[model samples]
Structure formats: structure tokens, C-alpha cells
Target: MITNEQITAYNEAAISVLNGSAKNAKSRVKVFRVSQLIAQETIMESVDGLHLPESSRETSAMILMNVCCNKVVRPIDGSCCQPPSAPALTQKLAAGFFGLSIAGCLILHLVHRHGHRRSRPCADVEAGEEKKAAPAASACPSEVVLQSCCKLGLIMAYFYLCDRADLFMKENKFYTHSSFFTPIIYILVLGVFYNENTKETKVLNREQTEEWKGWMQLVILIYHISGASTFLPVYMHIRVLVAAYLFQTGYGHFSYFWIKGDFGIHRVCQVLFRLNFLVVVLCIVMDRPYQFYYFVPLVTVWFLVIYITLALWPQITQKKANGSCFWHLGLLMKLASLLVCICFLAYSQGAFEKIFSLWPLSKCFEMNGNVYEWWFRWRLDRYVVFHGMLFAFIYLALQKRQVLSEGKGEPLLPNKMSNVLLFVSVVSFLTYSVWASSCKTKAECNELHPAVSVVQILAFILIRNIPGYARSVYSSFFAWFGKISLELFICQYHIWLAADTRGILVLIPGNPMLNITVSTFIFVCVAHEISRITNDLAQILIPKESAALWKRLACMAGFFSALLLLSSIRGEHRR
Candidate 1:
């Protein structure tokens, strides 16, 4: 039996496998044969632990390796080298940019302070009406206080810009297509900007990464401030913005994990559930500002399909042998089952809508006859749904190891239940497709197809259950886009607000193409820039006096409170 000391030695050596400083560790450990290594429990456990926590796993492994190497090797050779620190220029520039961004934030904060002072109640309506008067006066900060704060002053300027644009828009009265056209153009331009910056400007030391995280937190602050101070509508209130802010942060957190490559079923579930949180919140809080009803189907269909397909996918990872017909057939059947679920969903939804017609809830979500046409109204809208599905597939692939492992050692039955499920799914999809194809007119299709919605929901459940079927094509690309999706989603309105104020696209009245093209382009670039700046800021700012995760989140809440003032002001002004 291996002594405890020997086992400890073996565990350290195993960790050294990934550690950077273990250059000579291999030579030292080579004294022991492969048989000795295979017999080590610590080594096996270390390797097993590698698949946990998507972020920091690589670093953790490195640390483990380094520790092990120290124990086994006198002077580790061929170990990973520590990266040199950033050059002075990089550091200086980072600091300079960071300071400038903070200054911007400070200015905005000060302006907000001033806005509050001005809004303070005067001695009017004292004594008897004191209670009512206090509530009214305390309702919001005053305009005078706002003007005093320089940072808020810029926000106010933006608000005025929006106001001016709104006047122009109201006069021109853009139709649906025209509305999104400008924004699309701006988004493209932003993409180009990001592409130009893709070259590695500098490598971030661990310290720098931490600093950058702080910077990111601060940038979030700016948005939160603007949300509270700026003139957005009541519907676009601070509470809603905060929820979206959580989503943005969550996405960033998830991305950190994705890049690190440590994935499992639990992590996948977290991402799915977190993303769903935003979807649910938005559904409850926001009305489709425009005919942007497309986001509903766009976001819905992909998750629905992927969830269902994956939920029932026979465990391909479990099979120790090479791939076989059973795997392929099982996957196909799983997909089919999803389709069947979708069919049932569609039928059920239709039934509900028919029964609930004129019901208060149904009225709010009355669908058009040709739901597909509604979905296809903007080609881009369809892309959102397409991308959503793609993302689900991508997540599945990333967590393939865990999913496949789960299916291992199961009895090999014909999987008759899966087959039946698949049949139902296929029929549902076909039925819905037929209905879509046979629709007489777009107007007739305007009545939202309840059956179609059901189909989507069922599909989602099926995809979620499937295993090893999802192959994501564009991880990096989509990740980048997804990172800023919140910005694109929110800034669309701001860009529109700005352009309408400026009368820039007034000539192309009712042309959504122009609106989408220009506004999207500008919105994307601006949002991307803002994102970069904020990320940088998050690195600099810390929850000083050191705290826990929940406390950190609370700090964020405080930061958001400051930002909410900006949003409330903006919303109030807009209204």
C-alpha cells in the first residue's frame, strides 16, 4: 500500500501536469514508471476535478501542477513560464483611459446631485397639507440640482438630443421597417470598430484582469446612472433596467467560463436558467416598444427547439464503442419527439387562445393570423430566433462530456417511448408548417397561431433534453454579439430617439430600412464603446474594505441606485 506521504507526493505530481513551473517535474517523476502513475489515486482525482467550474479551472490546474512540481522536481524544466509584466506604455495608457472614464462617471454623478437639490420642495403648501406636500416634493430630485451636476449635464444634453430627434420623428412618422434600418447600419459600423481593435493591444496580467473587472463594474455604473437620470418612459423604468443589467453581467460571467473551457451539465443549466431569467422578466416588464414582437418568437423558438431535442437525445457519450446507428437513430428520434411536443404545444396554445379570446390576458397578446409573416416581417428578426437556436446547440456541444456520461450504463431497450415522442413532434411541426404555408393572407395570419406557439414550447423542452446533437458553428462570433445584445436591444430606442430628434431620416418617412440601418449602426458602435469603457472601469473600482459576493452584488445595487436616478429623470422627461 502507498504510504500517505507517497500518495500526497503523487497528487502533487499530477497537479504539476498543468502547472507552469514544473519544467523538470517530468524528469523527476520519470524515475517512476507509467504503472506507478496509474496506481496513484490523487492523480486521478486531480484530473477529475479539472472539469468543474468553467472559469479559473485552467489557472487552478496550473497552480496544482506548480505545487506538485515543487515537491517532485528540484528545478522544474519545460514548465510554463510566467508571462512578463505589461510594458510601461500599456500600463500608462490603461491608467489614463481608466481615469478619463471615471471622470466622465464623476461628472455625471455630480450633475445628478445638482438635479436633486433644485427639485427640493419650497415652503409652499405648509402645515395642513404638509404630508401630501412632503410626498410630492420628495417624489424626485429637482431640475436645478440636475443642472449643477456636470456629469448629469452631459446626460441632460443627450436627453435634449433625444427630445429634438423625437420631434423630427413625430413629424415624419416612420413606419416599421424605417424604424430599425438606421440602428442596423450603426451596429455594422460598431462591428467594424471592434474588428479593428481585435489585435492584441496588450496582455493583461492577473492584476490587470482584476482591474479590468473593476472597470467593467464601473461602466455598468454609468448605464445605471443614465437609467436613473435620463428621460426614459415609465415602462422603461430603472427596475427594468436593473434586471437587464443583471442579465448583462450574467452573460459576461458566463463568457468568462466559456473561454476557460471547463463545462458540465450544471454550468449549462446555469446559463440556460440565467438567460431565461431575463426573458421572463422582460416579458413581464416591457411592452414591445415597436412591432419588435419578433424578439418573442426569435428568442423563444431556438431555446424551445434545442431544449426539447437535447432533453430526450439518447446518451451518445455513454457508449464506449464507436458511433453506431443506434446513436444516430436515437438522436433523430429525439428531434422527432421535440417536434411532436411542439405540435401539442401549438394545438394547446391555439385552444387556449380560442377559449381565452377577449380574456384580459389574451387581448394583451393577440396574435396575427400569419404568425410566420409576423416573424418574417423583418429578416433580422428571424435571425434572432435562428441565433437563439444556434446558441442552445452550442451550449449542448460545450457540455457534451457531462451529457454523454449521464447516458452511460443504461439498459439498451428499443427506446419506444422516445420513438412515440418523436412521431408526435414531427406531426406537430408538419401541421404547423402546413398551416403557415396555407395561410391565405398576412392579415389573416395576424391572429397569432396558438398552435405554433405550443409547437415552439414543446420543441424547447425536447431540445433541452437531447445530448451530443448540438454543434455550435460560431461560438466566438456569437459570444461577442451576445455580450452586447443587451446594449443593442436597449440602445435601439435611444438611437431612434436621437435620430428622430435630429430629423436626419425624416425624408425617408415610414422606411424602417433607413431607420434600422442608420440607428442600428450608431447604436451598436456607441454601445460597444460604452461596454469597453465600462469593462475597463470595472477593473479599477473595487468594493473597498473587502466583502463577500452577495455584498459585492449589493454594491452593484448601490451603483445602480445612482444610475437609476438618471434613468428616471430621462424617462420622466421623455414622457
Candidate 2:
């Protein structure tokens, strides 16, 4: 019915509009294609000289595709694709890290030169006054600082490469179920390599404790690396291992205080620094929440609790308390008060949450908003540590009474008493197994943990006390591992496992065994280096002579000021 001229004009307008849209879409597609090309070229250049395996290259490409094409959904209109944005922050961080590494190298060079010049003067002075001569300084003001800086830079580089070039980043998925062969293999290896202690020692001697921790740590590492947290038995046993660590903490600190009877500022600072230095540094470098590294904070808090309880009570600090009964009563009273406090926290969830979520420390609880997280972690092994302290008290008291075997002498008790102890230990072990097997949920497990943990802890104590077992079962390998267990645990959060312990990175790709071996070797080396650095820092921070109150105040002020500055920078960067 319409005129021919009008219809032709309408058709021409429609064609022009479609042409405009097509042109825009074509330009967008061109931009995306160019960006993709550039990303591929950059990645290829980065790995060109490395001579990576074919599987590794393929994996690397897949990782890059994932990172670059992430969140780019298909358009219903079938329009142009948007290009991926570059990881600008990650690149900037890598640059800053390399710059710091260079600065550290320069500082090391200067320090070495200065040390050489000062050595002659120090030697001359020592020659003049042999009696008053100071000990020679170690080489170059502790290369620990340089080593730590370099390692940090390397870690940052790895992270940046994985993020920017998308080398090893992959979607995290639950691994398929596997047999218990891996864990069994781990146990058999540990047992086969076990070496008994040659000399006579106490039931829970330093070596034995270290060995226990070492074996537990090794098992835990396997569980994590193998992604076996889904397995209930492994998970439950890991919980027990963590509880053992807390037990050791309680026993170690209590024994030290009981023997030395000293809780000075210097001691507190030393312990805090040893536990927290690396963690704090990582928090700044990696932009992670303080609580991301929760174990250190947990131990630090426990240490504070112990210090406050002992330092406040004059009776506990008294070198020569009148009666053994009186000392025992005082100790029990303190522990009872602590138990009451813990109970109050457990019962009052709101109060507990409010306390942990308070300003400053709240930064740590950012990842998990609920106070239940903090409570669950605190309550799981709550009584286990106290059990350790109680055991230590009884052991020491028994030693004082001369009723127990002091060294390698006669049995502490008669044959009947020994038999009874053995029976009790067996019952305790069976009880723990039953309790573990019955747990239906994490909440239920946590609820029963404090009660059931006592059985296993006691069983281990009794077993260790058995004369025959004690003499023929020591593992130097475990003892060595135990010494650096803290480092291994902390360092594993980043390089060893990635994505906040959720996923594993593929370094060698196709060959799983080769990849694991390479990763583990590097991980161990890094952890050992960190251990050395921690020791060096301890020596530097904790002076033999007590620092003056004013000097200590000044140091704290400077430290907090630096931390504030770092926090501000991080906040700005985040924005």
C-alpha cells in the first residue's frame, strides 16, 4: 500500500545502521586479536631460552588461555570479543621486588667492605686486652638478610610470572579418590629409617619430642601435597598432629618457666620475633591477611597467656616455695582460672567474635567474617595443651620425690604397676580410635576433640615411659625435621603449594614424580634458609643483656611506625 520511494529510503537507513554496527564489531575483534597475539608473544619470549618440555609448554599455554580469557563470556548477539586486561599490579610488584633485590646486593657489598676494614681494628684491640677481648663477629653481618631478600624476590617473580604470563595457574578441582597406599608408604618409610637413641634420656626428652613433631610434619606435608584432605581418616589424624604441636608448645614453655623462672621483656620479644618475623614480612609482600598464617598467631596468643599467668602470680615465681603440695595447689589454681576463661569464651560465641574482630587484629579475620572460625580453631585442641602442662608438672614432681627412674637406672614402678600402666595406655588408644571414627561433622568433631585428645596424649606419655620402648625407639631423621617443622609449615603456604593451599602448580607438567621431586627439593631448601634467617634474627633482636626500658620503647615505636607506613602503602595500592 506504501509508495515505492518511501520504502526504498527506509531500507537504505536500515542498511546504514547495520554497517555502523558491523564496523564497530570488526574494530573490537581486531583489538582483541592483537592483544591475544601480544600476550602469546610475551609468554613465548619469557620461556624461550628455558628449554621447557613439550608438556610444560602446552600446560603453560593452557594456563595463559585461562588467565587471559577468564570471564569472557560468549555474546548472544555474536558481537566483538573484549580483550583481557593485563595484570598491571602484578607486574608492578615484580618490578619493585627486583629493584629491592638489587638494592640488597649493593648493601651486602658495602657491608662486606666495612666488615673487612673493622676486623683489623677489632683484632688490634683484642691483642691489647686479651682478657677483655670480645668474640670475633661472624662473616658479613649475617648474610641472612641478603638471602631472605633474594628469596623473597624469587617468590614474587614466580607469582608474577604465574599471574601475568599465566604459566602454572589452573582451576582448582577436587582430586579423584585414591587408595591409602600413599600414607602407608609414608609410614613405612619413616619406620624403616627410624634410629634409636644411644644414650639414656627422659620419657619425653628433647630428641623424642623433636622426632614426634618431625614425623607428624612429614605426614602432614604428604597429606597436603597429595590433596588428601577429603579423606576422613587423614583429616582426623592431621587434627591430632596439630593438637600434638600445641601440646609441645604448652609443655616446652611450662618447663622453661619452671626451670629458669624468668619472664623478662627480652624473652618475650625474642619469642614473638621468632614466631612472627617471616609472617609479617609475607603479609606485606604478598598482600595477604595477617590471619592467613594462623598457626603463628595462635601460638603467640598461647605464649602470652602463659606469660601473664606465671608473671602475675608471685607464688608461682617464688624460687623456694615452702611445700611441694603448696606449689602444686598454686599451679592448679592458675590452670583452673585459665580453663574457666576458655570456657567462658567457648560458651559466649558473640563475645569471642567481638574480641577477635576488634580493630587491628580484625584485619586477620577478614577472610572469614564469623567468630566461629577463630573459636573452632582455638577450641579444637584447647585442653590438649593443658594436658601437656599437667603431665609435665606430675613428671617433675615425681622426679623430685625420687620415685621414678632418674636416668637409665631401675624401673620407676613395680611389675604390677607397669602392667597396669600398659593396660591403661591400651584402653586410652582404643577410646581415641572409637571417638575419631564416630565423628559425623566438623562441629561434632571439635566438640569431642578436647575430651578425646586427653586419651591419646596420655597413651603416648605412658608408652614413652615404658623402659623397653623408650630405649629402642628414637628417630634422628624425625628429630632433625622437627627442628625445622615451623619453617616447613609456614613456607608451604606459598611456593610449595599455591592458591592459598587450594591447588598445586605444575612445574614439570607431564611427569608427576619429577615435578613433585623438583618442587620438594626447592621447598626444603627455602625452608632451611628461612630457619637460619629466623635464628639470626633472634640473636640480633634478643640481646644477652636486658635492654633499658626507654630503649625498648623506642624500638617498639620505630617498628610500629614502619608497619603503619607499609599498611598505608598497601591500602593505596589496593585502591
Candidate 3:
């Protein structure tokens, strides 16, 4: 719809600004004007027919600029000059650090090898037993370097293949016509079924919880890969799964703290180290903020909150086993207080922002200019964790009182009572599903989520464990995956998927099924390796002895201090 007169004005303005930009930066007014003009959809329709012949060099640049900027957002604050791109400077620094870490490892190996070699040589030529230690001495570094290169090469190859090669590029063509069947089909194919001996099958035991995590994680992965977020029902269900995870985080940690009552610096350090280790590495390597992997931070925050809540008062332990109504009342009061605080924070984003934006804490948690993302995330699952804690307390209390019991072949309640509960649980779950599916928009669904998420979660638990056999059996397939579920969740950000999981990594190319299979094998292997590495590191870092623990903590604190200094330097650089 833009006229020829407008086109001419645009061309002239662009040329002048482009020329002037060499000597001095173009003003926002000029850039905005140019961007605004070219963003018209009609311009593309008329692009081929345009007849204004100008200087070849400027004209070609103009044409390219127009093409790149077409349908792009209008400039605001002169940011249009910088087209969208990855966090280049940060990514480069991450890459540099990655290489440096590898180099440092090689150096350490060489030093150690050299020291060992001095004591035991291939050729004591003075002893004349052999002609050469020279080649043997050379073998360790060369062989080690080659081995290191191969490892580095494999990682670099994945980065290049995923990014530059476009073997698995972000594609929305498939998403435009996405279907509910896609995820369902994926679920059916990745069926959750496995068996184990029934000797130790308590309700919500390790295998049961692992199976829950595994299946939930798998569904989430499928939902993402298939771009099923467009479906309100699918999105709602996924949100519930995430809520369930937070619920487990609350339940599991609260149980540990209350029962073990260790409250030692060492236990806290170990848990934090386990949860944050991969996330911290990813933040540096992927040039993402800590809040970018929001789940871990959410879990970490909740864990600390639970720790403080229990650690502060007259400490109650499982060993303190006697029935104390006063202690129970105290626990309930603590939960109520936490709920109030959660509501207060969730009620006002401004208050949430103000509190988190405080200086030292702000440095760690803040993303970009504010904490709105954190606020949004925090508000979404606000009550789930508390619900988890409440559930844990109730279960533990009942168990303490000999009021409820669970075993391998025993139903949660008496037969008739179990049947009634089963019916109620199934009805509740179905009703919730129906409600979730009927919601027309994300806003409508999310508004009800924090309050009602517990319904579906509790309902699922009842349906899962009310029956003796059902409670006893869990899918070992899912449990295996659940063990590495954290790594899988974090790793999918980079290698298993691409574009931060906007698309799948096409390791086999062309054949989607084959690619998925191959990529999955690699992904699972990688997750397992990361799990092993994390456990190995934890063994060294988190010692049982209190004295050893403090030294490790001090070293970790120093490392974080340096990281904070670097971040501050970067912030100043931006200014």
C-alpha cells in the first residue's frame, strides 16, 4: 500500500543513513524510520518491480538490508540495527573457557605422567637394558593429546552439526499443523512397563517415584518435541506434570529433613551440589542465566526453604519418636506461615521483585533487568511444594501413629474403603482432565492451576497405590530413565535437542524415526555419563566428616566469588 513517493523517500533516507553510519552512528529516528518503511508486507510484493537504479554498491546493500529487515519488527531504541542473534560474546567466552578447561586437564596429566616416568623409565640407557625412553616418554603426551582431541572433536562436531550444518534446524512448518495424536502416539510407543521383585514395594518408594519422574519426564519431552504446546489440553497436562515434580521435591526433601534431622552443613552442601552442579556448568557453557534452567533454581530454593524451616526450631526427629501434639501443631503452623508468605509474594509482582532485587541475592537470581520471569515461574507452582510438605507430614505422622500402613502386597486401606477411594480418585482425575481440556485459553487455565493442581496429583497417587498389586508394581523402564531424569532434562537444552529444544537433533538425518532412535541412544548414554560424573565428583567434594566438608565449601565459595567478579566485569563492559 506504500506509494512510490514514500518508497523514494525511504531509499534516500536509507542511503544517507548508511553513508553517515560509517563516520557516526545513525540516530534512532533514522533507523526507526527505515525499519518502519521496509517492514510493510506490500513492499515484498513490489520488490521485483522496483525500478529506481542507484549506485550499484549502495543499491545492493540496500536490497540486502531490505530483505533481512522485511517483516522484522520496527526499530525501537535503535535496536533494529542489531538483528536478532544468539548471545555471541557470552557464547564465545564459554567456548574459550571450555577449551581452557580441556587444556588444563591435559597439562595436569602431562605433569603427572612426567613425574611418574622419571621414577620408572623405558630406557635406563645407563643400565643399557633398552635403547629408548624417548619414544615411550613421547607416547604419553601424544597419545593423550590425540585422545583428548578425539573427545574434544566429538563435542565440537555435535555443536557444528547442530548449529551450522542445519542437520536439525528449527522448523515450524510441522508445528503449524500439530496434532494431539503426535504426543499420544509417542507415549504409546514409549510404553511405561517393567517388573521387579516385590519384596520392598512400599507406597511412593524409590522405584515408584522414579517411575513417576520417568513417565512424567518422557511425556514432557514428547510434548516439547512435537510442539504440542499449541494444544491447551496438552499444555495443561504438562503443567500438572511439572507441578507434580515440584510436589515431589517438597515431599522428598521435607521427609529427609524431618526424619534424618541431620541439618548439617554437609547434607545441604551435597544436595545443592547435586542439583546445581550440572545447571551451573550449563549456565557457563551455554551462556544462559541461572534462572534460564528455572527448575533447578526452583527446586534449590524450595530445598533451602524446607531446610531452614526445619533446622531453625526445637529440632524434631524420627528418633524423637514419641507422639507430641505440640510438635505436630508447630509443624502445621510452619506450613501455614509458609503458605501465607507464598501468597503474599504471589499476590504482588512488585513486592516479589523488590525483595529478590536486593543486592547480594539479586546478583545470583535476577535475569536481565528484572525478576518477572522468576515471579511468573514462582507464582505458577506456588502451592504445589507446600502441598507436598503437608502430604509428607501427614503420611509420616500417620505412619508414626500406626494409623496407616503400606507393604508389598497390602492395599493402602481396607478393601471396601480402597474401592470407594479408588472411585473418588478416578472421578476426580477425569473431572480435572475434562476441565483442563475445556479451557479455551492459557490464561484461563493458569489462573486455576496453583489451586487445583493438587487435585490431579493426589488423584493420580490414589489411583496408582490404592490397590495392593498396583502399589507394588512399577515400570523398571521408567525407573531407569528416572534415575538419569535430571541429566536428561538439563542435557536436552543442548545435545539431545537443538535451538534450546525448539527442535530435535537429527543425528541420522532424513529418516525421522532413525534419527530419533540414534539421537536417543546418544542422549541416554550422555545422561548416564553425566550422572556418573556428578556422583564421582560428589564423592570427592561432599565428605562425611564435618571438617572436610568446610574445606570443600570454602573452595567452592572461592570459585563462585571469581565467577561473580567476572559477571560484574561483563556488566560494566555492557555499560
TM-score of each: 0.31, 0.76, 0.76
Across 2-49, the per-residue lDDT of candidate 3 in tens digits comes to 886887798787877776657545543344343434444234545365
Give Cα distance to truth, residue 110, candidate 2, Å.
7.9
Every candidate's CA RMSD: 29.9, 11.0, 9.2
After TM-score superposition, the amount by which residue 131's alpha carbon in candidate 2 deviates from its true location, in angstroms, is: 27
Report lDDT per candidate.
0.38, 0.68, 0.74
Residue 284, candidate 1: Cα error in Å is 11
Model 2 lowest lDDT segment of ten: 74-83
Which ranges in model 3 have alpha carbons more than 4 Å from their true place?
1-168, 176-193
Position 232, candidate 3: lDDT: 87
User: Model 1, stretches more than 4 Å misplaced?
Assistant: 1-297, 308-322, 351-440, 443-490, 497-521, 530-575
Q: Where is the poorest 10-residue window by lDDT in model 3?
A: 74-83
Deviation from truth (RMSD, Å), model 3? 9.2
lDDT of 2 by residue, 1-575 (tens): 55546756876676566565674555432222233344444555565643434555565565556446644752221122223245444335546766787688778878868976765533346467534345766655446556656665666555444322345633243544453356657665875587865365676777788888888888888777666677665577678888888888888888788767878887788888889877876665565666778788788888888778777756473354434577778888998888888889878888888898775666555454445666677877778777777777777767666677635644446778878998899987777777666767766776777777767776776776666556445788777788899988987776777656765655687787787788788878877777776787577546666555447658866965766565546566767
Q: After best superposition, candidate 3 residue 130: deviation in angstroms?
A: 22
Worst 10 residues of 1 by lDDT: 196-205
By descending lDDT, how would the candidates be arranged? 3, 2, 1
Residue-wise C-alpha lDDT for candidate 1, range 1-575, written one tens digit per residue: 65758867886777666464555655444332333334342444454653333334444555556546634552212232222222232224333543464566577668768986777656546464433233334323223223223332333234334432223332222234323334345444543344212112112212222232332332332332223222222112222222222322323333333244333344443334333322332221232212233333333334434433444324333231134556545644654565465455444545434543443323223344223333233222222232233333334444443332223223111356545665676676566556655666544443443214434334433332322121111123324555555444444333433321212223245785575466545555765654453333333332223344346457756854643444345435657
lDDT of 1 at 402: 38
Write down the TM-score for model 3: 0.76
